[model samples]
Target chain A: MTRYTQPTTFYTKEHEWVTVHNDLATVGITHYAENQLGDIVFVELPDVGAEFATGDDMAVVESVKAASDVYAPIAGKVVEVNAVLADKPETVNESPREKGWFCVLEIKDGAEIASLMDEEAYKAFCEGL
Target chain B: MSDPTTENLKRTPLYDVHVEHGAKLVPFAGYEMPVQYPMGVKDEHLWTREQAGLFDVSHMGPCFLSLEDGIGGGDEAHAKIAALVETLVPSDIAGLKEGQARLTVLLNEDGGILDDLIITRPIGEAAQGSLYIVVNGAVKDADWALFERSFQGKAVLTRADDRILFALQGPKAVDVMSDFFPGCEELKFMHHMPFELSGTSCIVSRCGYTGEDGFEVLVKPEAGLPLVKEMLTDERVKPIGLGARDSLRLEAGLCLYGHDMDPTRDPVEADLAWVIQKVRRERADFPGAERILKARAEGPAEKRVGIRPLERAPAREGTMIEVDGQPVGIVTSGGFGPSVDHPVAMGYVRSDLAEPGTKIDLMVRGKARPAEVVSLPFVPHNYKR
Candidate 1:
């Protein structure tokens, strides 16, 4: 039941969402992405302290239908992951933008977040697909 | 996503209904079929297991094979028709009771399975000596050609490919279907009969790809929408798409013709030896009987077995399986079983590695994930007697 209300949230063409709070950016897939993947059964998350470049494959989200790669929208080091998803993967479908956040990353370059699409831009991008 | 060349795809009789119900259509078996609906594949799959799910199987090939001369006068004419069909596939067709149906495999001369089909002998006295057969949509043309060539000048083939075939499956299917067809509840699994529905003569078979007790109704194309809409009026009945159909059948341990087994694999290797009856084995007269019987006696080099991956990651089709670091087989069908709530797969492995409890590794994205060779039917079947 979690809602997407945060205004600082950004999105990638791969359907990942990034919400910047101070220097840390929280990452998770968008609802549009979860709908396409169907019922998620497994999620492979990166470990804390792991470094990733912008657009690098950082996690794998597997659903009943297919497996998809979640890429990092900004270069950063993983700081935290939603360990709850290990046991309740359906959260990605139920609350993808909020409690279903995959991980929190310590941002290395704040400017990379600006390059991503905002909510309005992301909506249009999804429509194009 | 829409396909640019969707005009080239064939649409089923219920295509507009699917579109109206918010189905996500995709190209499958040359048809623009609905893969899933707004409820999603997982929900559709689980719903069918608990209630009743209706599927548009109109894309499949449903036809009748009748002897040139009218049948039912005596056993001689019936036996002649059965013998003609036996020439193409290995099954005890002559032993099939009037209303009984049998699942058989179409074999090539080299002992490979061309396709798997359901053949049922009509029950009505008027339709005697006629066999109602349903083959895979992808290979229906080839099957028709085989039938024409094999039964040249002996029998007349009637194509009902334009007919609407709907499969109403799951636990509550009997209750919902019995209300409509009245005597359908009396038909046991693998039995079929001709019934009149709303002034339309239709054939209802108490069988389905899903392990659940169900009935497949074949009606005229014009009656397809009305029949489906009427069935949906029942609270337990929901329109299911191919996505749930695949998962449900996979959990039931039913093989998908192209994905699980194709013309390259034989029945014995596919673990379908039961389809080859004792009488057929003794006669050794069907196509590829020499190699099929030999494999049945000595065992096939590789056999299909169910697999349970120790990890949550599904080992999809084409994933290589290894035993103690040595490659032995490849997965033919693998996916997350919604009913079992785990990842299940079926693959062909060396006969030695096909035993239950044998430990193996599935190469998923180049990593060796632990798995075990287990028995088929990730979920137990619930067929009504």
Candidate 2:
């Protein structure tokens, strides 16, 4: 628990977003993800207490076009999930960065998230695509 | 990465129109086409059911097959052309009335379906010996080749895909079409006629992919370009892209060529036994009639049926269908049905399990999702019968 220093938000190359605060993290897909996915119909969440290693396929997001996998940003133990997504999957499209979050995790390593792209870097990364 | 596939893709006559409407272009069946406009897919799909949606379908295969030696006159000439083509298909082409269109499938020697198509005999003495045929876009080359091989010295086959083809679909389509063609509103389902549009004669058919009452118009690009613009200006019509076109057809229980039916499967297996008319069944002279009639009598091992996911999860293509922990079938086409407001799918299940209300489970992402084998057309067809 005492491995790293400051808190920060980061993004993965696969278009997921995460915010770390102390030992806990909040995770969701990015605005780019929602836009690319179009109208989302279902969000299949991982069960509470489910464990995942970095880069593992952690969740599934099914849209009208197709289903896409949301990978784990870092090693983490799932503590909570957004139940609202089951009823209102479009929330992911309406407010992807805020209320449209997927789940919360008890992160294992701060260094894994620290090395990811920042908001500015992610903007540039998406621009290149 | 180098895009070898995108290098040879073709563009439609309405490419500029789609770009002007802020369409997101994607490569489909060797063409650069709009998958959706700025309004997005879901809204585009719903709009077509509630209002008129204009779809550019120029990429599909529309061709004219006529007798090579030229016709003498009247119903005899139409029968002559019809009899020649009936050799390849099981449907009674010779039985088609003037201006009437019938849906049928092209078959291989083993009773496997090569492609599904609509063939319409023209309605006049001048065009008596010619048949207007439309096949799927993806397998068009093979379809044309089949035609060329079968009718080499007997009939002339000409490709009409260069001419712009478009569909106006939805509940408001008849109202929109009437403003252009005076008698379009009165055209019966599965029928067509020649109409004057943009000062040029065009073929207008009261048929569509969406289950709505609509028209499919074929015209030269010069006239088509302006007609599309004029229709968009009207309040009832909007430009719809391929994405909506797909969901609309799926909801309507229409089959996508490569997805639902293929060369390895026969028409009976594809649940298209209705295409074979009774007169032809008795005659039984078409290709693979022996094997096809056998399937019709005894039924195919697997049958295509409608599947509705009881849960929120969508069972996509290639998803396994199971019963009692045993594999029974696989989903052919599945997606979020915007109109139904849930996940809708179609698949081939074993004959015993292909009944309406039959309970099954779809393996989506390795989890069993409860589903039911329901009757097709998740939405009711509103065709003007």
Candidate 3:
């Protein structure tokens, strides 16, 4: 079972989204990223306890067409991974925002979250592409 | 994401039609081709297997090869022209019957594959001396340059690539094409005939790369737009893209030039020895015939075979194949096979380990993923005999 907090979600230019709750952050690709991938068949998630730097490659998503890398949005240590994606990678395409969340990280610095875009700014960023 | 680079990419005659139907265009073989439509690659690939799928193949090289001294009527002219082309390829072109076609390869002097192509003999008596040829788009200029050097004044090459060449493929291809070209069912697999439709001349060939029962139509530039638009109106026919095309052919065990086989690989090693006729093998009279025949007799050191990744992930091209950590082979093409419901791949392994059921390890992302050597065509071909 997981606990909830008053959360604030932020977006990255590479199409990743992170929702911060105190010192913890949950990471996943944005809906726009998954839609572009199309029918993702496999998702390679980082192991729990793995450490990552800002913009480091943390996961890989593969569609029938090709494979794409998902980068870490902020420096942190992974605490949990979405294991359900191993059996049902299509969840990324079907419900990218909710059930498809990739992993949870314990952040080292709260200030890094400020560099990401808000919901409105992220939606506008996708439209320009 | 890339506007500057795409600005220089060439567009096909049906570019506007693809855009109108919501296709995602990407750079392929120097052309901006649709990689998928709103339906996406997986759905589009399965749709082609269950129903008919239309494809824009305008980028392919289509041409007519004929004698320069002016072609004469009857069998004699065909024999002369076939003899000229036979000098470059290993297939028995001279034996091709009227309206018959053969899938063959362009060989280098050392018998390495330059490109794979289809050569056909037209039906009409007046078309005897000419052979209809289609080569890969990326290497068309190189192929034509070789032809000019070899044929010189002996033969002439007339390129028809400016015209629109499209393929209508799948089990229901006949149903869709019948509405456009009646009496098409009479043509058997690997055969073709010319047709006249409302002042437009078209060549319909009963062959395709997807291993499905289908037709490849070569249409003049003037009538391409309207004819393709009309074909799309059929519910069974949907426009396919390069993404589905790759997966479909991979499932069919067909080779893509510069992938499964290249200039360094010969026919026998590529498991394409079937293209060589008995007469050609007996005579030993093609470029690099000595090396190719020697490998055929004793077998090549490496052989291309079908492979399946036992795990969920796919082993893409350039993935190394090993046995207990020892490198033995390498994957040339691989990806998720939507129809097979798993990952299917093709690669070259040591001849000793090429048999079906031989176990191999695929080095993907620095990890040894278990895989097995399997027979070709993960999906059975549905060609019309």
RMSD of each: 3.1, 1.7, 2.0
Interface RMSD of each: 1.2, 2.0, 1.0
Winning candidate number (TM-score): 3
**What's model 3's lDDT at B296?**
94
Clashing pairs in 2: none
lDDT of 3: 0.93
DockQ-derived CAPRI band for the predicted complex in model 3: medium
**Candidate 3: clashing pairs of residues:** none
Deviation in angstroms for B40 in model 3? 0.3
| Residue-level lDDT tens digits of model 2 in B1-385 | 2357768899999999999999988889889999999888999999999999999999999999989988548798888899889999999999998899999999999888899999998988888889999998889999999999999998999999999999999999999889888888888999999987668888999999988899999999999898899999999899998889988999999998888988888889899999999999999988889988999999999999999999989899999999999999999999989999999999999999998999999999888999999999999999888
What is the full ranking by lDDT, best candidate first?
3, 2, 1
lDDT agreement of model 1 with the native = 0.89
Q: In lDDT terms, how accurate is model 2?
A: 0.92
What are the per-residue Cα lDDT tens digits for candidate 1 across A1-129?
223345378888989998887788899999999988889998888989999998888998988877788888899999999999988899999999988999999989877776889899999999999
State the fnat of candidate 2 relative to the true structure.
Answer: 0.76
B283-364: candidate 3 lDDT, tens digit per residue: 8999989999999999999999999999999899999999978999999999999999898999999999999999999998
TM-score of each: 0.95, 0.97, 0.98
For model 1, the DockQ equals: 0.62
User: Higher-lDDT candidate among 1 and 2?
Assistant: 2
Q: Compare the candidates by DockQ and give the number of the best one.
A: 3
Higher-ranked by TM-score: 1 or 2: 2
Which residue segments of model 2 deviate by more than 4 Å? A1-7, B1-4
Residue range B1-385, candidate 1, lDDT tens digits: 7678677999998998899889999888889999999999999999999999999999999999989887674456667788989988899998888899999999999879999999998775666778899999999999999999988888989989898999999999999998888999999999998887667889999999888999999999766678788888789999999889988998999999987888888899999999999999999998788888899999999999999999888898999999889999999988889999998899999998999999999998778999999998888888877
